[model samples]
Target: NLNGNDLAATVGRVQLAKLESIIAGRRRVAARIARGLADCDGLDIGHEPEGAESVYWFLRIAVAEGAFSLSKVEIAAAVSAEGIPVNPTYRHLPAEAEWFRERKVFPPSDYPWGLPDYAGDRDAVYPCDNAVAAVESHFILSIHESWSDADVDDAVAALRKVADAYRA
Candidate 1:
């Protein structure tokens, strides 16, 4: 397989050796971003759960509904306009996709769900309201191990500026 090739394996080993340092740098940047944005209204920079740690590859910022005059998309746009890279979180929900709704898997038939031993609903409606809400309300700010503290500070500033300007 391509993944097991000698060149890829050699690169992987090099990355593995520096993985700890990379993760540490990511954590430090994420923490600085969190602290800088802590006082900003209507934005939620999520926390690490008890006894858990995160490398914080993407910082998910949830904009509370009704907390701002602008929607999450607009807020993200405003941040992006300030030259900060911001994007809406996952836009597609599997439960709401056409493939899932039509049971298109395995073609022409429901397959597993249509089987006699299957106990689940064949025509299940998965509204996934919470998932939908989260997607609508959240935007992602990419964090990287190579990010300087100044970069993190700029992102926080842009977010806070947009939030403050649009607070309801």
Candidate 2:
């Protein structure tokens, strides 16, 4: 787990500034955050030969836009139970869930949320399936397709507020 100082070490003084750039939606600045995030290859979230860099970009933007963290499993479970389809990709994961517990990390949920009946098995595991990615896609699409920027902001605000209100 990355304590504040540990994270600080990995993220560095300049890196937090980069993260701040991501928060502010300067694409150039967000690129720095992405690079820093890439440093933690231990997490396996950084690799994607696919279009997922854009996905990462959206996540940075969304978080910058007001989104914050939830317990990854909780988020995955919520999205999965929402009929959004979950892929439990923990199999063959480089690190076990225990490794991530140090950081309270949520493993990613995979793409193509709201799977069809036949596709659940196909889409339900990591290496190919991811839980964080699933929840992220669902909400990002929700923001992109049906909402205004103000609506997206309100929604991000609402998500954070709801999470905060439920804090134990």
Give the range where candidate 2 is weakest over 10 consecutive residues by summed lDDT.
59-68
What is the C-alpha local distance difference test score of each model?
A: 0.84, 0.38
Candidate 1 deviation (Cα RMSD): 3.0
| TM-score for each predicted model, relative to the true structure | 0.79, 0.25
Please give the lDDT score at residue 90 for candidate 2: 29
Q: Which pairs, if any, clash in model 1?
A: none
Clashes of each: 0, 13
The true-versus-predicted C-alpha distance at residue 29 of model 1, in Å, is 1.9
Taking the tens digit of each residue's C-alpha lDDT, what string does model 2 give over 1-168? 355776568758676666744544534333443443343311112234565444233322222112335444454344345443333232333333543323333335322342354354442333435645543433321212223455444433443343354334
Q: Using lDDT as the measure, which candidate wins? A: 1
